[model samples]
Target chain A: MDITINRGDFVGLLGPSGSGKTTLIKTILGATDVYGGEVRVEGQSIAERRPRVGYVPQLETIDWNFPVTVEQVVTMGRVRRGWWYPWQRREDRLVAHEMMSRLGIADFAARHVRELSGGQKQRALLARALVSSPRLLLLDEPTSGVDIKTRDEIMHLLDELNHQDVTVIMTTHEINAVAAHLPWVVCLNGGIVDSGPPADVFTPDTLRRTYNADILVTEYMGMKLVAESPHFFGRNERGSADSSERGEHVHAASV
Target chain B: MFTPLQYEFFVRALIVATLVGGLCGLIGVYVVLRRMSYIGHGLSHAIFGGAVASYVLSVNFFLGASVWGFVSALLINLATRKRSISADAAIGIVTTSSFALGVALISRFRSFTRSFDAALFGNILGITQADVIAIAAVALLAAAALFVGYKYLLFTTFEPEVARFYGVPAGWTDAGFSLLLAAVIVVSLQVLGVTMIAAAIVIPPVVARLLTDEFARMLLLSVVIGALCGLGGLYMSFYLDISSGASVVLFSAAVFLIALSYTTLRSRLGSARWRRRSAASGKLEPFH
Candidate 1:
């Protein structure tokens, strides 16, 4: 997949499981072994870009009972290029404090990350990623395992971060809830199937190839919504909703 | 207690046992937290092989045993990380084989003398002033490394995968921890014995965990609990005519039981009070 993510681009990687979405992100981070093409950021090579990039791992992968306060978790990102130490330094603590305050988690700085609400947990991870003031941020399923309100809060935070010229790229399973709202989407299976604005790329042809399922694509009030037709056992015999339609379901969907 | 203090050997044993206890507890926090408690047990058993090898070659115990133990520690760590072998299988294979080597060497060379018996159980009564100094030195070195690598240790322990992105040298940290853990086990051999050392390393931290949720507090509490256990155990051994290592481990077990009971009872009482409040209000609501 030969694709370029410009400095200001806000892109969402959308695909089914085992779609190489995360591997691509790790390839960019230089964490995985590569046999072929190179990954470069700006004028620098792969190794140089990893320190400059911020990555938030999947929430499910985190050890929530780690016994660290939000402040400690935030300052973890302050161990940038050459610095490695036992505790957060004075300036690192200040930077962490500032970042926590900016994320509206200042009040919870001393609280353990385990005690955080779903939204606060996401924000804490965001604060940790942002503490280094990276020009680029990469998140893996930031909205997964969160409620709708929390997901919206996370997306709003990322949008705000992107607008500030942070250059956000994230891999998400949330298609309609997340990728459809983004300005750019990369549909991938084993490789990039297509890439464009959501409205341009979210056609039934492209989504089917990416997801290998009949995905219902609808637009409501200019927002692209992607969903799967409900499988009704008896209703399937009445008429396969997908069977009757080539592109009719796009218009057939109601508000 | 005061009469036992008058004996120089008793004083030396006391000092060495206390230092060893605190050091094990200090390092044990990482072992227990990382779910690598078996590493401590496995490494101690492996270090026994190193001990025999050192004695056979007439090498300095610390130098030869440390290098041997360090290599074994590294091997166990590497094997576990590869994940080709299950953690228990890896530990069991490596550690038991190494221990068997030591047993074979001991059985083969009958020249390897009295300390071998002490190594199995413990020989605190036979402790020397030099042993005390060695334990203190190892304790200091472990403490200094922990102090310097505090953040790295915490990050690696808490989040190994993510810590690397922020520039924490996770591999080096793991190697260093393995080396330190091996050294602690080796030095603790005389005071706590191979049989009891794992408990000394594991129990204090575990008891502390039940008492507090904070990491720093847990570390401090573990160390304190370990030191006090050491002191109390030694006194009990002297008064009750028991083995020092056995007394210390038993004391630690007692503390763990107390902590578990206290936390469990506190939570039960708290829930009962909350239930009373809900019944009075005639509605389900949050206790807080």
Candidate 2:
């Protein structure tokens, strides 16, 4: 709940379901009312410069069968900066085409968006987000339902964008994936329970505190991973966890 | 067609049909795509109150209907803005109450010459030159709005949340769309009638959707289908001595059925061909 994301930072938000991850994002978008504080960007209120933030929503937010071409969908991102007319200008179309080609979706520019696969759809959304050249990009579960290969490709694309000085803030449930790749991670459950490098925060104590369940955490190739505690299978009572059992759980939780 | 054009009434009817058909069809693309087809029914009924009020006040029917239609649309939007009332519920409450108010006013105004039957069912032959000009002008305005606001409309229709995030002026676009929808419904009420106007607003675009996946092509096809249905239906009604509205709706239905059958057959045949090719190539069929 209390954090500062510096410019050009790539932060991955990790939380369990109903842990206010989405609510936090919505508050950042100024879509939800914040009673006690203000959300500011570059010392200005978020409302004053909201257009500088690009958002790639979850796939379910779009209508796949909508009667629009991929090029048209991407062209929509230019609304804030493009010509006042509804039709995109020649140069605008060229810009959109270039962005699509960069995203590797130029081949399907004329095709209906419904014809796209899951990764292609995400890329198309990403293309739309980048068409406006925002300073910060926010995504809601970009890797949900995608294959591992596509997820890695999307993460690499985000990292590449970050290298270009475009900040990225994404909410993801993939603990190990974010742990392995992202430099900053924040675990949230109603509030920020832990925040630091993945190696420091993704331990048994933080996982249990954030998830409210016994979990096993391990590391491979210097990247941490988390799984549900095996003792959780039979031990439904929290009172039954003895001190020795808790110690064993932590040992198993962190490798 | 040649014989019908000789008479002034038939000519007026044909001109009106062409204009109304094209207008409804063009607007119907948005209606069907956004799944807001109920606006046609709701606004047509809401405009009836305005027509009856026109009769009582001796005002121009178009002026009264346009005002009432626009106000009713805004009211529906207002009710929906708070999220306290569902869109359909708002439409139902506002439109049905306006319609009931019209009936009540009509019952009180015994001196008014315009009959309720004419308002509810429409009279194609009753169109005058002034009516034709008004309809033509409003249709032109609607067309122009769509032409200039295509991207905003498409964005809002497909993804309003994202559109708003990028400062797409979602509020203005929605208000403009609601006003346009109201105008189309009110104008078509004279030809398609209050009850059947929604069909004209829905059928053509749906048929076009069956034929193409592209939006621009679908818009063109919907207009073509609408204009053809109007001309063919009006002519058939003249020859067969039937209700022109009913004839037009039936013609649209027949066209829809044909498009449906063609689309179904094409997809089936396409899949069968794919399956045969896969078998010939010794490839396993992927489980859907």
Candidate 3:
């Protein structure tokens, strides 16, 4: 897929499980090798320029049992600065403090990271990624396990960061969370099934092609949402409501 | 304390202990944080075969052990990456196989000297000035590696995926860390020997964790605690006529227990004071 992310755009990668959303984001961050296509950030190939890319990985991937404080966690973003000095400058610490406060996690700065709630931990991770002040921010499944309120809060935080002109590119299973807020959307399953605005790409035909399951797309409160039918074989009908309530249900059905 | 020759040995032992202890404490922070403590045990024991091979060939023991350690480290890294075997299983495999190899090598040498026993249990009194210099060099290199890779190391230790995403080269970080650990193992073999060196690497950091929440401060405290254990162990060996290596380990364990108890008591007292203050202000809430 050939796509360009501008300096201040908030782009959401929307796709089902096993889709190549993560691969696309990883390619852009230069974490995954690109075989044929090119991923350019700020008119330069990521492989050539090696631009600063702040990444917030899915929280479930972290081992919370590892003992570390919130401040120490946030300070990890500045690791690429230099080798001889390990200490963060006063300005770095101040910026971390500001980021923590911005994320509403200032009270938990001195607390052990394992003691944080799910939302708080997500915010802490986001704060850590933001401390480096990268030109581009890439997040993988940022709201995968979060509740609806927390998911909206996280998206709002990203929106605020985007307002500050930090380019945001996030891959998430939570399509409804981005349908109303994100400026651009890419729906992919192994390859780009469709790419455009959320309203344009989140169609019944696109959803069916992406997930290989019969899905129904409906409009709720001026927003597009996917609903998988109970008659569909192998589809967990019970999970749809729970997932939809969490704003993460993306339904695609095979004919 | 008064004899010149005895004092020279004592000073040499002190220098060796400090160098080994300080480096172990410093690097042990990363090991403990990364939850790779078993790697210490695995590498220390695996180097025994190399030590025995050196003895058989009449070569420098440090060089032999380092070669063995590097090989074992590389093998462990490769096996863990390539095969589906868990880290503990890899450690078990390398340590037992190498230890058995060392034992078999020792059995082949029929001279039946006390040097083999010394290598197993370690004899701090036998520490030479040359050993002290070698230990210092190893410690210096370990310190330099830690200093240069401190941030990346911290990043990898805490959030490896995120570190990789930021282009921190997690693979190289792990390899560099493993190499540093092998170096520590080789140097520590002088005083801690093949069998007991893992304790020297572990106990101080475990004890230091009780005293501080900050990583940097914890490192400093561990080093101090390790140095004291080494010095006190030597003193105990001289005065009470105990095994120096065992005495050192015992001193460190004792420090760990004391620190644990002290921290527990302090926290209890502090919580009690907070409760009393809150109760006096009529703002105390009932415990759930």
Candidate 4:
């Protein structure tokens, strides 16, 4: 909890549901109260610094029926800079167009938001959040419900952003996909259970403690992966007795 | 067949309707886009109580209604934020109670007169020169505020949390927006009456959405459509001897229906064209 994130660190918050991972990020972004501890970005408390913090919320939080185009959505980032006119500045428009093109959504710039696929929508929102040239980026479950390919694409995009020295702090349940990319990790279940490199914090003990179940860990390609035993919760009594009817045992293996 | 003296009222009604209708059209674009139509409706009805109270106290009805409407708006906003109540439920509570109180107070005064009917149903025929000036000023102020706060308002409407992270105080914007909506509702009530104001505030923007995707175009188109509806309804009322308020709302609804049908037809044709192009490109295949 007392650790410091440097100016360009790519950090991943790894935890199960009900953890304080989101609370920690919200506090860092000054969206929540930070009474006992201080959150500083570049030698200034977040409350005083007012750095541009780009936030990507969970996709389920938005009302998809909202009437907006992809380009218009991205231009919303400039709203705080006193550009309220419908016709935006040439520079802002250029930035927005470039961001959309970089995100591979240039063709969708004129399309209504509701017509977008899930991956397209996520990329559009990502472009929207990044168009203002924010120094710090926070993403909450950006890969949730997305296909594996899309998830990797989004992570790759974030990795590229991180390479450009933009600070990134993201939360995700997909530990292995992030372990290879993220340099620092914070594992939390109601509090900071562990914080260190992903390999050190994503052990079987940490996973079990975080998820409240017996977990098996395997190391492959210098990354820690977790698998939960289905019998940890016991079997049902009133169900079909056949092995096939026992419901395929759930096991998650990640690298 | 129209005499000059009688035609003056018609001309005045057309001008006043165009001014007020255009203002509502511009503001209603935001109202519908933000899903704040219920707030608009609530403010409109709550202002009724204020107008009634002012009437009973022999005060300026507009002043009473604007103050009361703003207070009611603030209370509704606070209740929605501070408590667990839903916004629709809160608005329903505030508007119904305030309007009922207004009706009760109005009942205690002298016998209900034709003026009460005129106030409830709207009387474009009796609008004074001062009324015209006041409506024009309110309309201009609303247009200017909308022009200045357009982007911030859109940002807040679509993604409030993101707007807040970028240093836009979304809550303050909401309060300011509610105050502006109150002003719109007050002016609309004076012109169209409370029972008919929601139609004027809702239909034009809904129609505009079918016509365009650009926000500026939507605003401009909605204003034109609303003014046209207002003027056309006024003329129809003058000639056909119908209720002016009802005629205006009906004309707006008619326009909305026509626009909806047109958009649907256009989209279908666009999709057909896309299908033909894709087929020619050998991208279309039959599903088994």
Q: Where is model 4 chain B poorest over a 10-residue stretch in terms of lDDT?
A: B110-119
Model 1: residues >4 Å from true position, as ranges? Answer: A47-50, A80-86, A232-255, B280-288
- Order by TM-score, highest first: 1, 2, 4, 3
Per TM-score, the best of the predicted structures is 1
Docking class of 4: acceptable
lDDT of 3 by residue, A85-143 (tens): 76666676788899999899998888888888888889888998898888789888888
Across A149-222, the per-residue lDDT of candidate 2 in tens digits comes to 98998999999999999999999988876544789988999899999888899888998899998778887787
Residue range with the least summed lDDT across 10 consecutive positions in model 3 chain A: A234-243
Point out where model 2 deviates above 4 Å: A34-36, A230-255, B279-288
Model 3: which residue pairs collide? A212-A254, A213-A252, A213-A253, A213-A254, A214-A253, A214-A254
Give per-residue CA lDDT, model 4, range A26-129, as digits (tens): 88778886778777776788877655688888888887767788888887777666455455677787888999898899988888887788888889878878
lDDT of 3 by residue, B144-217 (tens): 77777777888898876568766687989988888788888887776776667778788899888888777777
Model 3 clash tally, residue pairs:
6
TM-scores, all models, native as reference:
0.91, 0.90, 0.82, 0.87
State the weakest 10-residue window (summed lDDT) of model 2 chain A.
Answer: A246-255
**Per-residue CA lDDT of candidate 1, range A10-59, in tens?**
99999999999999988887788788877887767785555567889888
For residues B1-288, what per-residue lDDT tens digits would candidate 4 score against the true structure?
Answer: 355236777778889887878888888888888777877777777888888888777788677888899899888877887558988999999999999988888788765353665566677887888888778878888887777777777788887766888777678888787777787777766568778888888999999888887667888999998888888777777778876777788889988889989999998998788778767877764421
